[model samples]
Structures are given as C-alpha cells and as structure tokens.
Target: MRLSICAVAATLFTSTIAAPTSKFDSLANTSEESESEIVRRDGGDGKYFHEPGGDNTLGHYDKRYFHGVVSDEERRDTQKHMVRAYLDFFRKNDLDTWIAHGTLLGWWWNGQRLPWDFDLDTQVSGATLHHLGEAYNQTNHSYTSDDEQVKRTYLLDVNPWIWQRERGDGMNIIDARWIDVRNGLFIDITGLSETHPDSQPGIWSCKNYHRYRTDELYPMRETMFEGVIAKVPYSYDKILTDEYKESALVNTQFNGHEWNPNAKIWEKTEETLRQEEEERKKKEEEEKKKTVEQAQMA
Candidate 1:
C-alpha cells in the first residue's frame, strides 16, 4: 500500500500497454535457470531498494509522495486476483483463516471491496502455516476465464521462517504472501501463535512477539470478506478504537477525496479545488512576469 506520488504520476498517467497473450507461455518455455534468476534491476535513488516494513515506514518518505508505478485499474485487478488466490488456497486446504483490520472493515458491509483499499490482510494458525509452506511455497497458480481477456496469473510466496520456531520480539509470524507479480498487489498473512491452556482466555497472545491475551482481542465471529468466505475479530471496535480512535470511522478528506466513515468508501469531489487553485495562482504569477518583460522589450 506504499505509493510514491511521483512514481505513480509518472507511471500511471501514461497510456497502458496491452498485456501479451503469450507472455506466460513464453515464460513457461524459458529455461529454469533463467526463470529462477529473473531479477528486477535496480535504478533511480536507493529509494527503491528500501525494504517495506511495519506501517510502511520504509516506503513512506515524503508525506505527499508514494512509490510504485501502476494504474488504478491495474491495481484493482491485482488486488482482486490476490484475494482469489488466497481463497482458492483456503478452500483447497480447508485451512482456517480470517480477514483482519482494514480488510475486516471491508467485510463489515457487503462482501465486496472498498474502492480505496490499498492492500489485503489475513491471519492463519501455526499449523496451517506449516501446511502451506511445505506444499505451496513459491508456486505459480493461474486463474483463467471463459473470456480469454479476463485471465490473470498469481504466485504464492511462502517465507522460510514458517518452519523455524524461534521465540523472539523481532520475528514476524506470517508465513506466506499471495502476490500479483504483474502489478505488485499483495496480501499479508500473519500467524496467530497458539497459547498454552493454562494461559488466560480472552487475551490474544503471540510467543514470537509481544504477548496479548484473548481478552485484548475480545470476540471473533464469522464474516465474509473480499468476495470470499472468512472470519474476523469481534474486537474490531476496540482495535479500530486504539489505532484510529473515532477518526477511523469519521468522514475525512485525503488526496482530493472524501472518505466515508460509515461505509469506508472514498468519494471524489470538490476536495481537489485546493490543488486546482494552487496551480492556477502559480500560472498567473508566471504570466504577469512575462507581460512586464514584453512591455520593457517594446
């Protein structure tokens, strides 16, 4: 969900290239050595190399600027594919997982998506994490439609840490990522560490990180998210309260759009007037200077 404004404007403002129908076929026919080593060469400032971590700290540089090059349509398609892949995996394996945080917010209404959603979020159990890492790590799965134009591809990227059981503060419990390589949209999967029976109920706890009991998380319930079957924490009210307080549900303006608190949708409107006014004043000042110069020349 980290976007560099300059990067987005530069990449998306231009026309899109039609994706080649035979692209995946060509990739499939290529040698395994070459395919395994396919790396995106680095350029520009060292900015692109920075690792995206908690809260997008690495990706957020200028408050106004974001990184990555992708169109809105392409971005949406990427996210949709990611969600589909996760659901497919869940259905096939019969694994129990649920949407969390902003993702859960999307589920609060219809099973559809929020127009401004930046990324996908979900959680899995430790046992389920092991099952995926062992069988589906770094695997490519394709979704095809009867209409050839709608087909898309995705990859399951399972991290190695799922197998390692080290109790420490810095470790991340998440085991895998559902990636839309073509557009870079991804879903983050974190594990809910199992607690001993003697431990208190109602306090959510994770041994790999700071501990919290189930009470901290309160209730969990069944919910549908991203047009798929899933579950979500019942403590969503408390969770949002801590993170955004009442503002999480408050209608506010961002990037020339009004974000609806109740519906969690971003609507475009007169919010862009300020940006337009600023651009207009700048042009007027430049024009006035040119007029003065012309009179002196005469």
Candidate 2:
C-alpha cells in the first residue's frame, strides 16, 4: 500500500523513545498514537480503511510513503545531520564503517552528495551490527550547526533483528538506521556477513548476502563526504563494481539528474570539461607547429 508523505511524516515524528521511568506502569496510557496506527496498517489484515485528513480522505494504499519531493536545500540540511550521527556512532563504538552503493558514487566524483539521492547507504560487518544493537539502541546525538540557532537532534535506530541471522535470509542483515525524523531522510546500515562452507576458523559464511573476508574490507580510508568526516571502504572500486557495473561509475543520469557521458551532470560541467580539453589540444598543436618551423630553420 502506498503511504502519503504527510502520514509517513506524522508517523515518524511521533514515534519517539518513551521517557524512561523507574517502574513500569501497568496501565500505560493507550491513546491511539500515529505510529501505532501506522504499524497496525502495515501489519494489518487484508481489509483496507480510509483516514480523514481535512476534506480529502486518504486510503490505506495512499498512505504508503516512498521518496517525496524534498527540496535541495532541505536535502542538504538533512544530509549534514545524518552524516554527523553516523560519525558519532562509529567514534563511540570504534566500529569500521564506510559509504557504499549510490552514496559512494556521490563521494567518488564530487566529494559531495548526489543532489537527487533520497537516502544514504553504509556497510558494516555482522559483528559490528551485533555490537551496535547491544550497546547503542535508541541513542540520541546532537550537533550544533554553523548557525548558533540551528541545533539538530538525531536518533540512532539499531534494529534488534541483526542478531537473528540463523534463518538464512541474507537481506535481513540490514541492521541500523540514523534517521532524521524532521526531514524523512535516513542512512541505511547493512551488515556484510562472513560466508564459508565448512565453518572453519577464519572462514566466513554468508547464506543470503554476498560474502567477503575481513582482510578484504579492513583498513578503512578517511574521506571527506558532503563536507563532513566520512569513512570509505578500502577496496571501494571492487565494492562498486560488484553492486553496480563499471558503467554506473561513468553513467551520470540517475534518480533526477541526467547522466552526461562527457560532463558530470550533462548540463554544464561536461561542456566545461570539453572546452578545456579542446583548448589544451589546440595549444599543443600550435606548440608542435612552432617547433617544426624552428627545426626546419636549423
């Protein structure tokens, strides 16, 4: 079912961590919260219902949320907070993590975000995810922006499902998310499980997801991404190629932006690069002709 942006936004905003109390209240207030409604709808039976929102009534299918029309300014602001939360988690736990997939593609060329990207993707080991779930569930992080008035609070969403890997469903390893509730932008954290057949020591086993050795992914590299401290995989090229073919590195058009074979965005940057190359070639030819004339005189 399709969820509307407003409904999704409302659900996310209200699903905050419950205030801690020394004693559990047997009769916890059960006022029908937006999040609970959303959860019920998602987990509900086949019967669909309509929800009232002013003159228009939104249906169950209409409420499913995907990528919405987020402004560029809003995206940039949201990305900054998401990156900060990721870095904070890594630093606190000493876990090695790096940007992957489309996020890495953005970092590769511009050292910035893909203006059209809806979310961020990062990779961690199975062990790392396990560590985070146990130690960092529902942690709060705060970052002060360059402007003193803009203080952002972020929540760490480490799903408890990371430890349930015995079922053989590989895709379930996606373990955590650093969600920006205000903007609906999130960072998806996936665990790269070890895959091996014999269960031998130093041999990893990944039943559903792709397998890689610790040595292959170790020695994380430091890189600047979206104007923040970021980590990248050691063999980033291999990872990219495995996920997306070599063409993806060169393909410019994706999401909303047009892929320019010659330029970065296909609109302006390619033209600039082409002009620069043409000018360089013309200068080289002129220099060559001058050298030939000088040689003939000698």
Candidate 3:
C-alpha cells in the first residue's frame, strides 16, 4: 500500500535500547551518552557523526562498525533492513520524509536499493527536521524480520547545526542520519527549506545546494521501497532528471551491471561478460569475412 506525507505521523513505537539497570548502570549510561552529548555540549564544530578511530567530521558511514568490507549479500541485506526500519521509525514518530538521491533512483527502477550503492539516502521537510531533532535525536529503534530470524537496530541522530538553515560552512550538509549500529551503514537525511524565503518564493534547497520547486516536492507520491511503504517527491522524474540527467532513468546498464527484466533486478556475472565479449568477437569476424568476400568478387 502507498503512504504519503499526509499518512505519516503514525504512533506505533518500535523497540529501543533498554536502559541499563545493573549496579553499574550510572557509569554505563554516562559512558554511552557522552559520545553524542559531548558533541552537543561543545556547541558542535559542525561535525555530527564521528568515526570510531577517525576524525569527527566524517560525513556518512562510520568505518569502525564495518571492521572490514562486508560481502555483497551482507551489504544488500543490511541496507534493506536499514531502509525498512527507517521508514517504520519515521512513521511511528510522526515525522515526514521520503527517499532521495540514489535511493529514489533505485525506487524508480525496481523498488530496491541500487546494486552499486553501499549506503542509502532520504529527505525530510524543514519542519520535520526540527521535530526530529527536538523529539527523536539520538534515539534508537529496533525491529525484527517478519520471520523473526533477523533483528536490527537503527539510531536517528540529528545534526546540532540543524537550525542554521543556509549552507554555511558545508560541514553539516546532512541534517541527520538513520544509522544501523551493527554495520555502521546509514541513510543520509537532508532537509529541504526555503533558503532565501524573501526572494525565492517556490524554491527549496538543502545545505548541499540541491534545489527543487515547491510544486515539484509537495503532495509527495507514495510507493514501496525495499518492501516497506515509502514516500517520494511529487515530480520524481523531473527532480531525478535535474540531478542525474535523463540518462539515469533510461540507461539500464551501469557500473558493469545490466538490468535483468526477467529477474526484475540488476545482475553482474563474469561468465556472462565473457560470453558477450566472445559473441562480439564472432560478429566482428563475420563482418570482416563478408568484406573480404565482397572485395574478391569485385
């Protein structure tokens, strides 16, 4: 079933990290809260999510969680769970958001994440951004698969510089993130607002300078992505074309992978590529032989 901007704001609550109750609960809570709370107290140097061993200005994924690069199957499975949990959390928290960037493009193709993408992207309205920060920043949401075999936890962490509407220092282009604590994979959540409200009437933009018209985004369309109901921009085609150009929608082959319509997914096979190369060589040989035969006849 489709879900729209108006349909968001559901009251269902997902599981969250239970508060520690051991004799060391106080110490554990202090340590656990310090990571994010310290950044907030420092007035934020504009960096939000920090890498475990790296600098604090890390933009998207946290390397510590990965340990090492995961296999393709693991990445896809984790991403799918991440997106579904994000949608569910937003709905329950009464927040409005939609798939954006590469994630949206994936939806257009087959309601799935792009095979080449290692992360996901989403967007929230300016108002929703405030609500998220004020109400759900640094909150965790946990969910289980339908069969209850797989369980995943996600953290909704908001950028402290969210109030700075303009694209000031560029350190906080992303307004927030839905992070999977297990693998450190996360969904970038940018916020759209009227950066120049007095002059730019209908224009909307994020800190990253990605702009869209009011009508192009309002009354968002609803569809499913990664097996969960989600929202998308109203003029998705136009928006995507503006960002990625017309080829994005029409080009089926990308990054060594080709769309398999029969399977309804993109596939990459070394054997298939080898076979294609052999077939191409055979055709070229046939054309050369025909040319030689024609010359002899003449």
Candidate 4:
C-alpha cells in the first residue's frame, strides 16, 4: 500500500508540471537601442530603470512586472524572501555564484541586505553566464510562502548581448537578472571574464568597468546572507574598501540613517525626517506654482 501511494504522488507531481516560456529571446535586438527606446520596448516605466544620462550598462528593469512600490517595511519583507529564493535556486543548480557590490557590503554589516537598499547584486563566471542564457533565460520559478498563503514567481532573464563581452558601447553592463515578477525588484547578475587572458591572466573585468585581480576574488568563502548560505569574495574587506574607500567600512552615519549596534539595524535620523518633511512641502508649493502658470497660459 505504501508503494502504491508513493507511485501515485510521483505521477501527480509529473502531471502538474508545465514548460517555461521563452519570454526574453528577443531581448538580443534591444541591445543597442537608444535609452528611450529601451524603456519603451522593454516596458520599463523609468521609475527604477536607468535614466537617459545615468549608467546605461546596468541591467534592464521592467516596470510592467512590478507590483508598484510599497512602504519601507513591506519592501524589506519582500526583499528578504527574494534574496533567499535567489541563493537557493543558484545553489541547487550547482552554478557558481557570489554576492557583489552593495550586496556584499550588506553581508559584511549584517549578513543581509542593507535596510535602505532596494535591489541585490550577484555575479557568475563567463561559462556559467553562457549556460544560463542558453538554458534558463526567461524561465519562471514559483515559490510559496511558509504558510502557503502567498506564492510569488521569479523570472531569470538573460541579456542577449552576453556575447559582446568587451565592455563595448558602455551598454548592457549587467549580464542578466533574477527578477520578482510580482514586484519588479531584482538581483543584477554580472559575468566576470579575463580582461586579457594571454597577458594578464590574473586580471578580470565586468562589463561595468570594474577590474579585480584573481587573488581578491578566488577561493570564495561560504557565508550566511539573508538567512541562507551564500558565497562571497575571499578578500571581502579589501574589495569593499577599494570600491567604497576605507571610510565606508567605519562610518556609522550615512544617507540620513544611523547604525544601531545593539539592534543591528539602520535607523532614520531625526534630521532626516525633518528634511523629508521640508522637501515634501517644497514640492507641493512648486506644483501649485506650476498649476497657476499653466492656468494663466491657457
């Protein structure tokens, strides 16, 4: 009887499985579109996407899939789940990946994302990037909450321009993204490649123009990030210091928030709140002035 039940369960699971869609196969053509065309064609609303004059190489941000911005408390809750799911998926697939940039800095401070941050950053080797683009791009992964009350789907979208690897045209720096289809939040995944394998074998570079020596990255260390096991560069301290400068490691006050050692969270400073209130009022006044001018012109 037990064997019969096991067979039935396995059959049921197999019956319910469905194939993934190739939603991102056409992304290759958009590789060189002007900034305006990119947002229009990609369904990005410009809220979280790259600005016209801003860094164009950053990964694509899709507003159509976004669930709109929520309060800070709610945003953090969603992010916590997003990151854990991301790490688990990569590990189970046996793909080599590690945290990078601000995400790495967050792991250094609290083994998680910084409270103020809205996205995550991760990286893969050149081989891994190609494999993912070919096999997993445009795939959707479904995850259910612990209580089974909420289910969110994530999309792994690969950049078609992964082949143009020479930091060319300063666009498409980010190689791919693991995106939360429900909220538009995502982890930017870049690929690291040999800058000059023939001459500078030890040197590597990302499309973003950041360069690193092998000793700074190799032999990745295992660590906890956002409550899941994750990998980080070996010389994390030096990497952070090199990118953000030494003061970033020691500074307690930043971006109108202060670190609370006991609570292990960044709290909004009183001054920051006051400044925000003033800014809100100023914006209101400016809007009112614009309304009056428009009325007079009409």
Where does candidate 2 have its weakest 10-residue lDDT segment? 19-28
Residue 35 lDDT in model 2?
Answer: 38
lDDT minimum window of 10 residues, candidate 3:
17-26
TM-score of each: 0.58, 0.59, 0.74, 0.73
Over 46-156, each residue of candidate 1 has an lDDT whose tens digit, in order, gives: 121223443543332211123554555766676766686677667666666667656754454335455566677776655566566667777888876435566666677
Per-residue lDDT over 155-190 for candidate 2, one digit per residue giving the tens place of the 0 to 100 score? 666644444443333433446777665544567777
Pick by lDDT: 1 or 4, better one = 4
Q: What RMSD does each model have against the real structure?
A: 13.8, 18.9, 13.5, 11.6
Which portions of model 1 miss their true places by more than 4 Å?
1-68, 109-114, 145-149, 163-174, 195-202, 206-220, 252-256, 259-264, 272-298
Q: Where does candidate 3 stray beyond 4 Å? A: 1-46, 51-60, 63-66, 269-298
Clashing pairs in 4: none
Comparing 2 and 4 on TM-score, the stronger one: 4
In model 1, state the lDDT of residue 280: 80
Error of 2 at 295 (Å): 86
Candidate 2 local Cα displacement, residue 11, angstroms: 41
Q: How many clashing pairs per prediction, in order?
A: 15, 18, 1, 0
Question: Who wins the lDDT comparison?
Answer: 3
Name the 10 consecutive residues with the lowest summed lDDT in model 4: 12-21
